[model samples]
Target: MALQISSDCISCGACEPECPNTAIYSGGTEFEYFGKKFEALASDIFYIVPEKCTECIGFHEESQCAAVCPVDACIPDPEFPEDRSQLLAKKVHLHGS
Candidate 1:
């Protein structure tokens, strides 16, 4: 599954830039991917775009958002469960391997 920023997020803006896929976004801010702009899902905390997130599979050993998050708000999304191969494929689709 993709990673998600829980309500525990402190809105520190620490995890936004560390994402290889640019999937992380500040609360209430816009996010772009594949030349398209996506609406913000959360207005009070940092948020992750599940369709754009690959758990840092192809680019890193672990989720960068989780790694840099000071409050441990980044965690797997149970609603979007996926395996390693699917995550890797998503990375390739987003970044063009």
Candidate 2:
């Protein structure tokens, strides 16, 4: 499943650099994907782009953002419940590996 950042986020910017897929972003900061930059989803707290989030499935045993989050704001997105194979495929799509 793709992980999500909850409202509990402290906006400390810790999880932003920890994501292997660069899915996490500071609130209100524009993010890029496929070479195109766009506005972020949230403007008050850190957020994760679900399209770019693989939960670190291809690179780690667990979500790096969740592991390093001090406030435990990063949690599974029940709206996008995906299994290992799906997550791996998404990772391959993002990294082109």
Candidate 3:
């Protein structure tokens, strides 16, 4: 499953640079996919783009964001449940193997 930043996020921007897929976005900031832009998921806390997140499966043994998070606010996203293979496929789709 993709990881989601909870309301507990401190908005410290710690997890932003740790993401391999560039799925983490600052609060109130917009993100783009292909040629389409989307609104921020959280206006006051950092959010993850489920479609672009692969839990760092292709790039790391664990989610980098969670590993580096000081408050453990990064958790699995129930809304976008996915298995290892699926996550790997998403990784390939995002960045070629």
Candidate 4:
């Protein structure tokens, strides 16, 4: 499954750069994927794009955003219930195999 940022996020920007898939975006800012732009998921805090997220499966042993988050605001995104294999496939889809 993808990960989501909670209300506890401090807007410290710690998790932004840590995301291997670049799925984490700042509040109220636009995020682009494959030349397509999307609205911000959270207007007041950092949010992760479920479609672009892979929980760091292809780049790290653990979720780097969660690892570096000072407030532990990053948590599993229950809305998208994907397993390891699905996550890996998404990683490949985003960054190539």
Candidate 5:
């Protein structure tokens, strides 16, 4: 499943750089990917894009953003449940390898 940013986020910006898929984004900051432009998150909180998230497969043993988040703000996205094989597929799609 795609990882998500929870309300517990302190907005410290720690997880942003750790994301390989660039799925983490600062609040109110626009980001473009997959040929689309997504409006920045409205809240002054960290956010994660489910479409771009791969649960760190093919990159790490676990989600790097979640691993480094000081407040434990990053968590599994319940809305987008995915298995390991699916995540691996996404990883290949993102990195083309």
Candidate 6:
């Protein structure tokens, strides 16, 4: 499943560098995906892009960003509960052959 950032985020920016897919970004920062850009959630907190997130399947044993987050701000996104296969598929789609 795609992981999400909760409001508990402290805007520490700790999870940003740990992300493999570059899915995590500073809040209020603009990010591009599928040829479209969206505004971030908060001007102070960090955020994650679900479409670009693959739960670190192809890159790590676990979500590195979540692992390194200090306050456990990163958590499973119930809105995007994907299984292992689905995550792997998303990884492939993001990187391509």
Best of the two (1, 2) by lDDT: 2
Q: Model 4, which residues run further than 4 Å from truth?
A: none
- Candidates' lDDT values, in order? 0.90, 0.91, 0.91, 0.91, 0.87, 0.86
lDDT per residue for candidate 6 within 1-97, as digits (tens), equals: 8888988998888889888888998978998776788887567788889988999988899899889998998999999988999889988888883
Candidate number that wins on TM-score, 1 or 4:
4
Q: Which is better, 3 or 6, measured by lDDT? A: 3
Q: TM-score of every model?
A: 0.95, 0.96, 0.94, 0.96, 0.92, 0.90
lDDT of 1 at 68: 88
Off by over 4 Å in 1: none
The CA root-mean-square deviation of candidate 4, after full C-alpha superposition on the true structure, stands at 0.7
- Compose the digit string of candidate 1's lDDT tens values, residues 1-97: 9999999999999998899888888889988877878789899998999999999997889888999888899999999899999998998899889
Give the range of the ten consecutive residues with the poorest summed lDDT in model 4: 13-22
Residue lDDT tens for model 3, 1-97:
9999998999999999888888999999998776688998878999999999999997899899999999999999899889999999998888877
In model 3, state the lDDT of residue 26.
Answer: 93
Query: In order, how many clashes per candidate?
Result: 1, 0, 0, 0, 0, 0
What is the clash count of model 1?
1
- What TM-score does candidate 4 get on C-alpha atoms? 0.96
Scanning candidate 1 in windows of ten residues, the lowest lDDT window is: 30-39
Error of 1 at 59 (Å): 1.1
Of the pair 1 and 3, which is ahead by lDDT? 3
Candidate 2 TM-score to native: 0.96
Clashing pairs in 5: none
Could you give candidate 4's per-residue lDDT for residues 27-61 as a string of tens digits? 99999999899888889998999999998997899
Q: Which stretches of candidate 5 lie over 4 Å from their true place?
A: none
